[model samples]
Target: MAVNLAHFALNADDIPTSRAFYEKVFGWSFVPWGPPGFYHIRTGAEDAPVQGALQQRRELIAGRRTIAPECTFTVEDVEATARAVVAAGGRILMDRFTISGVGHLIFFEDPAGNAIGAMQSDADAE
Candidate 1:
């Protein structure tokens, strides 16, 4: 049941502009993800290097301003962990869903209202 910090995502009203800014400022490269309007960010080449993503603000939460960057943690079992989240008093904002080749993901808010993501990779599920 070892959970590891997996990725981070930044919500942007304008995907291209925000992507350009990060590319220029941080020199990060991006690859198109499975879903349209989502891009996977590459920050470094280290083993288990922390990765990130740029997503449309509207895609994140409806009628809410973008807050802090969202952090995604990798879990061994998304469904079990999602249940654990509710048992621990956290609220699930998004239910488990597959990302094609990526994996399964769920979004939830902690007791303090901070948004977080959980991912269970396809490889790990097998």
Candidate 2:
């Protein structure tokens, strides 16, 4: 038998802010899943990709803020993707580097200053 995980939620200090950061960083979409303050974020993949997330926490109260970098993102192609993220207004937090036998990786800050990562599989690094 096989099991699949649908979505993951992070405690965001500010949902809208987190949403905007993620959307800009990963090109995802967010939708409501509950009351006014509760929401779901969907990460996009594979050209017209779809994903989902549920969120709730002590952040974002219509002007007040509490969100921070809350996740990790992996990509098969890191070089081009890093360039694209920058072109779209995001900043790479670190230069790409090898991680022992893991492969090449880089960390970046989203438009909202949330830390995120991008990686290239070992097979693709060669």
C-alpha lDDT of all candidate models, in order: 0.85, 0.62
TM-score of each: 0.84, 0.42
**Each model's RMSD to truth, in Å?**
2.3, 12.2
Model 1, position 43, has a per-residue lDDT of: 86
Query: lDDT by residue for model 2 over 25-126, one digit each (tens)?
Result: 877777786466666666565585443554656432334343542344567667876898799898887778775555687766668766566666574443
Pairs that collide, model 2: 13-59, 13-60, 13-66
Choose the strongest candidate by lDDT: 1
Q: For residues 106-125, what per-residue lDDT tens digits would candidate 1 score against the true structure?
A: 99888987788999989543
Worst 10 residues of 1 by lDDT: 58-67
Best by TM-score: 1
